[model samples]
Target: MLDAGICNYVAISYGHSGLWGGGMRQLLFNTRPSEACFGHFGAVGRYALAAQRGMHEFSSGPETWKHIAMGQRKWANLNPAAIMHAKPMSEADYHGAPLVVEPFRLFDSCQMNDGGRAIIVTSAERARDLKHRPVLIMGMGQHNPSNEIAQARYLAGPTGAHKAGRAAFAMAGIGLDDVDACQIYDCFTYTVEITMQEYGFFGRGEGENWFQGGTIEPGGTMPVNTSGGQLSEAYFMGLTPIAEAVMQLMGRCGPRQLGPETRTREPQVILCSDNGGALQSHSCLIFGRG
Candidate 1:
């Protein structure tokens, strides 16, 4: 069951993005199973974008690209250990980066880094025997939208995220109100913005407003991306969010940990999301302590 859940999330997040017009597609097409396909997409997208725009290229994509780049810069400002820390680039610096794919600059794309993470799952009864408290997979949900990316009604909205969220809530027998914290994937800033709406954390097009209010910061209302996310943290396919969820539940996230100041309780419920393609696919899961 756990393998199946991982497969579904990976397919929605990494599989679709692999289809983008670049070497990522080639890597995915050559890989086996959906999870492996998605893993290669991140690595290939980084190399392809870097090669196309020249090693010096920094900014990438449209105006929204700049917005997300700036967001990452802000997060980096708070995280001194970040690879890109103390190196926030200005819009002019963004413009100076060689153009990779028209709008995508070097900084616009997620950095390709090396890292590995793991999680252990067991029945609530069996969890007591483990080294740490077990974070129950209280509610789990997955979704896949139509394959016709061109015909999809909302290019910017995460239709799959909405569907996956509903399914997860139903499985967990909980409502959005029960969620305490979130670890939604932030492969791109627009993705985080759109997902905030799709997950019903904010209204449509209101995600940017939520971001502006600092609701996603460590002590903010939602406390999102506590691990720096794909934006400020390392890119490890869609698995990074899974690790963050585990950390949140285990109370092991150091400075990124969301306290009572940010949340009413140590996060008992965590909502994690994964995005693939041109925001074409999504997957969600809700975790809690057993």
Candidate 2:
């Protein structure tokens, strides 16, 4: 519609009900009879299990995921809208969480919530007249591999974010150093780790060192998932991260807001990622202050 100049503004809305009795697994993973018997079937646990060995070796061990899960939970503690906002967690608490899948504790998985969200998109000129600070879309990229996770190339290998992030950075004419924050898709804790590594935020096998010691949490050098992310906040799929990035850039999130007002470095550039279908599909969007 924008390409045809049919409208100058667009409103995107998304809603889902994972909390309801509806069976999302059946809906999303409708596999053929032949594919049903495959090793990677049904829920995401199997897929994560297949990659756990390489992930543990590359990122050090299962302990590395604790940082991601705990960090985001802390962020959630400060966001009233977050599902986990009232639930505070500690390192000890993270360690004690029961295993949902091998190498993945209960905290590693995102919760399903029923909610609706909407974001408005308009031309820069039109946005300038709006009440709030306009978040500019600097660059965007998407990549989806042809093969399934059963393929050797995809299982425990590079994700679509590798290429998608490169294209986004190239289009934006910026390096990883320019990113002030990240709103990485966190359907699972390890998802954030892999996406960051693929985006070159850290070199191969350096995720453990980079993520440890509260590097990506509030008051850390680079705050990530400031709205608590899908892991702690309500999961709305890709919308969770994308919406949070906009609020952060606009300096609108109260209490958990990122900016000089909160004694945190003002975010000028934000990187957002949306991963889908067992890391096979990825979309990278770079947003800048407008």
Steric clash pairs (candidate 2): none
Q: Write out the backbone clash pairs for model 1.
A: 16-277, 17-277, 58-106, 58-107, 59-105, 60-103, 60-104, 60-105, 61-103, 61-104
- Global lDDT scores for all candidate models: 0.61, 0.82
Please write out the lDDT profile of model 1 over residues 1-290, one tens digit for every residue. Answer: 53544422221223223334455445334444453555533333433432233222322224534555555555555555455666766778766777544335566555455444555554566566767777888776676675544365554444688888888899999988888878777765556656667788866544444565455654566666666667666666677788888877887665555566334357889988886765567888898866
lDDT of 2 at 39: 38
Best by lDDT: 2
TM-score of candidate 1 against the unseen true structure: 0.69
Model 2 regions more than 4 Å off:
21-23, 27-32, 35-41
Cα lDDT tens digits, model 2, 22-63, are 755553456656777663345455456645755755754467
Best prediction by TM-score: 2
Q: What lDDT score is found at residue 235 in candidate 2?
A: 84
> What residue runs in model 1 are displaced by over 4 Å at the alpha carbon?
1-82, 85-107, 260-265
TM-score of model 2 vs. true structure: 0.93
